[model samples]
Target chain A: MKQTQTLNHPLDDLLRTDRIPHIWCPGCGIGTAFSACLIAMKESGINLAKTAMVSGIGCSGRGAGYVKLDSYHTTHGRAIPFATGLKLANPELNVVVFSGDGDLFAIGGNHFIHAARRNMDLTVVCVNNFNYGMTGGQAAATTPHLARTTTTPMGNPEMPFNLPLLAWASGATYVARWTILHARDLAESIEEALQRRGFSFIEVLSPCPVNYGRRNKMKPMDTLRIFKEKTLIKNNAQPTELGIDFERGIVLGKFVDEDKPSCGELYDKTCRPSLTQGTAA
Target chain B: MEPAVLTGEHYMTGDEACAEGALAAGCRFFGGYPITPATEIAETMAARLPKVGGTFIQMEDEIAAMAAVVGASCGGVKSMTATSGPGFSLMMENLGLGICLETPCVVVNVQRAGPSTGLPTMAAQGDMMQARWGSHGHYEIIALSPSSAQEAFYQTILAFNLAEKYRTPVLIMTDEVVGHMSERVVIPEAKAIKIVERTRPRGRKDRYNPFEPGEFGVPPMASAGEGYNVHMTGLTHDERGYPDMSVECQEQMVNRLVGKIRNNLDDIIRTESHRLEDAEVVVVSYGVSTRTAYAAVEEARELGIKAGMLKLVTVWPFPERQIRELAGRVKGFVTVEINLGQIHLEVSRCAAGLAPALLVGHCGGTLISPEAVIEAVRRIV
Candidate 1:
């Protein structure tokens, strides 16, 4: 049987093609993460006219500038609150936040957790490249234990964050993870998350060729090869089955899926009494 | 005084009167957080707005509450937010955004004592400086002060009109006394009152840039999805709404923002000169403090002291030219507010270095009575 592939040509044109000799050398996971977002948007069937792309300050934040949509390049770590305002102001609009590991988990950690707990109706695509690429490869919250980078020249002493597990515990309705090598799978996960009714988070294990590649002494192609080899997409494996070693990066799928009331829907049903005849106590 | 349209009213607090005024002005969206003294305004809006198909939202925080009103205003609704000192402080950043983006909205600040969490239910006019320069950067502002509840309702309606006509944020600077005091106010029919809607671009969508200033230096606003790819930002922007940090662009934008109010000072600046026709001492006051000044002037008239009162209705853009004109004849000025010597300085400056400007003010909570203002007037006289 022949397979059907829905390629996103408009997104491909919108990408940095001329930089084809890209800032990111070949095999970088950023390209994979980027492709997944384009495919996800195409598959979600959301009206581009009512869609807004908001991002914070980071290499991942540059994703907003890349997309030919209504975009907001807000202050560092403030994308969640900004997108929150945009979503609540116009509930019909599809608001998505594209952020980096540092932008989402470090400075923006408070907003990230609260937004999840609040269960605001929006999609968050967080690209975890393990290190701060734009700022000369500093060790980020997502940097795996003992990783070497500009900040962690000898070895990273701090523990890494399990982003998907954190999102699940924090009340996010949908959570998933996929590496850049599984581009089609990553896109499918993103599409599923977007279609979900509440706060949806997709953690993409992107690779920074300029930072992660150079420090790890691996070529961009080798990084993609490692992603493909290390990732384990398990349908029945429990959380204990997946180990935390860098070589065993689990490609978790459909980790948490449940029906919960979104903040917008709840707000309309509760706070707004004038719209209906019901009274708010 | 043109035979007083609605006179002989009493027993109303300033805050309750402000609510009556908001209803009279047809304010539909009241998004706010309840703070002391300002709670009455929100409570009033909640009770009245829903009756008229208006929407009221108690948002997550003051920032969101303020932003929500701005958002609702863009959706073709007259919106307002009320807060005390601290909440007002929090709304400044977005207030500046409102100014730069040219969004028409109103914010009412019921002045209370503090640098941080001072008397919550008390009175002070400490935010006088803040009302003019609270937000960062330079831009024109229109602030009004009502000395009585009657004026509070009238001034609130006037604030909305000025905001819409100029496409700027208007501050209703009321103190705890004026905001919470009770006084009778005459409500007029909706048709008798005038309302202003923002100008819309006359040309096709493609030719419009949201920040492009028209003949009045106020850009016509087009809401989102109106087929106009309008761009707005807090940064200093050019005619096309693109951020232009160059010196020329900054100069042009700043000039237009300030000049719109500066040039229209005659029309925008308002004040009532009481018994100033032939008086030796002119007492300057605003908010609830002006009520005491009025009583002082009447008492002084009986005592043959020749004291008149200058009640400021428009607090910002200073009414400097009018004060300068008045300074030519008046012997001295006595300025009184809840706080220590805020508008007193402005009165001094506007006196053109002629008359001696004395200040009578209190620190926290409680109004400086008419007797104290009488004493100040007596000293100046």
Candidate 2:
């Protein structure tokens, strides 16, 4: 493996090479999803100097630590608000929040909703592995009903969040869903979000071979087979119809893409220069 | 550009004065949720920030408010957030994040009565100890308490300066009485008001370590978009600003984080004395209670008790040496506040049995009257 790891990789400039050998377990999908994001960022043509990454706590939250850009590894469940402040203050920077389902949905669910409702100018990427992969796979808000987790050996009894639907209902300007198996498509969707204005959300379904797959009696290859056989690509699909299904067919596509003024744009147009004029630095 | 500072005497509530002070201090970002007694500050900022080309956001909650403040500040803008008790409790976790990241920002807690939202609109000096120890770790914090609206304006600016100077969260711990009470606050001219910006990296960008200290043990802060590729985390990080999991790394990081404030006690701490010379008794107080303590000290002096009051301007460094020295000279101390003896307990500990430290404390929603303070002084004397 070390021999194959050459002195230069195409993505080396985008990575903190010194922080190599990341903490992700074998066959974990976060690495694939995170690299997809980095690829999107690199190809977006936006200034990397004016881009910042914000992450909350979890396995995927460690994504910010490996990036060779300005990043904030903030407190648990606070990545969006932190990114909001960064964007609003500078307005010139492209802020991205990359984190896990447990961090972004279960704990940070409120912030995600409000940020979307206000149309905060941010690109939020949620790596959904069905369970909390960082803590040996506990049941999470995105865990499919009947899925086995450490905390739910009998199977998760509740329904998981339909992320695409939630993002759509909460007023996301762009909403899409994809599996790690669709790496190219996911990266393209993110690139599109980077080029767009207002709130954008992309949910990436990933495999947790060491945690979720093992308990569910599914290997990494088995999950990959599911992603290959059990999913359908349907562009412009209705968001409400988007939900996870491994045995049954799963619909994957871009559900919402529209134009509206971001919160900052509206604030500037309505609230600026009227009260006291431009503030002296 | 419009003048950020309104230089003239104007009668305004302490909350409005605090918002104005933030403007004068170069705070261009205000992210907060509306809580009673502190809501006016947010209202003012929402109206005024954009006019100055600054940004103001009313976040979803106090946790979001604090996260936004820290984020904006890390983006290289002077930022702050105002809230009361319930909101303050929600912000404690992120406050620790700010401390560990050494992100400088001001947190204004215009305190209202609360064990659990006790008296939403009533004044209380109850969050004193909370401001110091509310966050989970053992760290020294800079906190200021203002007794009047005029002081509120000045202290808010001072809070920003100290935050920038020390690279730590500076808390303004005022009470509802001062927050809502109208008073004449004399604002200095725009160019006359002092502002301190965080030290930024000056040399080779690639070699600059975000956590490596420069002058005054404060590391040069590189904002997010500075091309420094700076990585700031709430984790225990090395000078390179990457997480280090070793025990030695934790010790070094935590120590430097705490020692920066502990070693500069003199520069950060402030206390004002009123007629304490030759006094047999001293009244220790801060925030709204300091106003009552002044009146009580005069009353005790009229009774030939040789009394005086020590007003705590910066409450968190706690002025321990002052308390210890006065414990030696003064016969006793009377700590007056609108709490169940929070500040009084600190005085008692520093007194160390050298003199009696009697408490004139109460629950929130009401002020500690001067008579009650005088009675406590009489007992202690």
Candidate 3:
């Protein structure tokens, strides 16, 4: 990758080029999703100096290490709370939690829901590859029903989490979903989420070819074809019907966006002594 | 507006005093979950932090609380959390993360009885060793224990100071008795309290290394969002704070972390050497057990057995050298604690067979009376 030293990468300013050749596998989609995030972060025109990225343990969790901003690669399932602390401690900071599906939904599921419930001013991007890619393609909380994995050789009996629906039910003020193939739409959605207030969640459907794809008959190209051919762009679609079905078209778009008061704003209004509106503690 | 420091005399529980102490120490962030014997610290922080322009969050669990505390500290805030044994157990994973990242924060473990929910409302000193090595992997930790509410306030401040100075997690090991017991505590003036601020990174921001040690073996911390573009991880990393998976990198990282505290034992270790000059039998104790041990030592002295109390103010480094030195002079040692035998093991190991360290202990829920401690001291005499 370093053979062409003269070529300048557009995202160089946002990347730790020294830690290039990241740990992502050959056909992994994390890099594409991460690039979208960086582009969105840059395009949003927020104070980059005041923005911090936090990630948990996984393929996508490694994104925090590669980011050029002040970043934290936290423990598994904990990126959300760590980001919450960063945001709440200093309201001036724009905290972003970027991690994989297993890290956010499995071990760190409780934190994800609570952060959303509080309507914290955070932009959370979950890269859903349908399995624990880092741990040898084991079954994950987001693994589709009857999907094959290392841990579930007989096919997964558990139904995958509908991430957008979960975020909706958990009171996220903004929610969207896009695949790695739709990088422009995903980046636009992320930029929109960054501009909006309150807890914003965006799920990127990325392919884990070495792990999830190899178990099924799908290869890297086949997964990309599914992302392109077998998806529907349905804006404001009902969250309950927003499940991922490879053969039956999976719906994707900006689903929820509202200008609700974030956790910090509400906390200042309610908990502080100089509240003019009211008080609940 | 309620000032962070309430400078006056007040009758309050140890937990409340500890909260006051943390506020006075410039701890502007507290993320905690409610647990028995330590809930007051969180409650007080929640009420007081916002008034002082700080932040207090009741997280979903102790793990999140610990993670949030570390995150707040990394975000340029002095952060803290309080919990019981079970919650403290949950915090171990993230506490290790804080240690690995060299993030400064304070954790208050108001320990209770049992291996699992033994007696949530009761007291125990069983987690003494857990505070030192509870987190996975071998790393040095600083822990302080308090015998009374007054001491709890001071120790909480000290915990923050040590955390800032060393750029590591500091544990305040108080138990159910001291945590819940109400006593007179005098909050000194803000100017009187010696608060330690974090040492900022010095040099060009573009060329900064987050983990490179400064003057006393502690790296100057650059909190998140300052534009240094620093990276922090739980994996073994180089001085630049990027992951370096080589075995050599692991050795350098671990050695410097352990050596940082080990080299400054004099500044970190705190103990009260009472009546040891003329005493032949020394009673090793800490936390609330020190109260009973002091009475026992005086009783033993009344009966012509020269005994003294060695009050361990800071317990994590274990004061091994002091124990070894005392072992040479004292004929024997009597260790007092509420647990079956935690610190006794340390005293015995440090004593190194030069002195016989006998344990007067029980399985928590109650304290070993002065009579039992005295009996143990008599056996040693």
Give the winner by lDDT: 1 or 2: 2
User: What is the per-residue lDDT of model 1 for residues B1-381, given as tens digits with 9 covering 90 to 100?
Assistant: 111122334466778777666766767677788899799889877766656556565655676566556555554466788999999997887787678767788999999999799999888999988999998999889999988787887898899888887888899999888887666776565677777778877878767777777756788877543445444555577876655679999999889888878878887989998998898989888887887888888998998899998888988978787778778888888898888788998999889577888888878688788788778777776
The residue pairs that clash in candidate 3, if any, are none
Give the alpha carbon lDDT tens digit for every residue of B261-360 in model 3: 9999999999998889988899999999999999988888889889998999999888999999999999999999888888899999999779999999
Q: Extract clashing residue pairs from model 2.
A: A277-B51, A279-B52
Model 1 C-alpha lDDT per residue in residues A27-114, reported as the tens digit of each score: 5566568778977888888776666676777778766655545555555566676566556656667778888989988977766887
Which 10 residues in a row give candidate 2 chain A its minimum summed lDDT? A272-281
DockQ for all models: 0.14, 0.73, 0.75
User: What's chain A's TM-score in each predicted model?
Assistant: 0.88, 0.95, 0.96
Ten contiguous residues with the weakest lDDT in model 1 chain A: A14-23
Which stretches of model 2 miss by more than 4 angstroms?
A1-7, A273-281
* lDDT string, candidate 2, B121-234, tens digits: 999888988998999978889999999999999999999999999999999999899999999999988888788889889989899899997777889899999899999999
Model 2 interface CAPRI class = medium
TM-score, ranked from best to worst = 3, 2, 1
Best candidate, lDDT-wise?
A: 3
Per prediction, the TM-score for chain B is: 0.94, 0.99, 0.99
Roughly what TM-score does model 1 have, to 2 decimal places?
A: 0.80
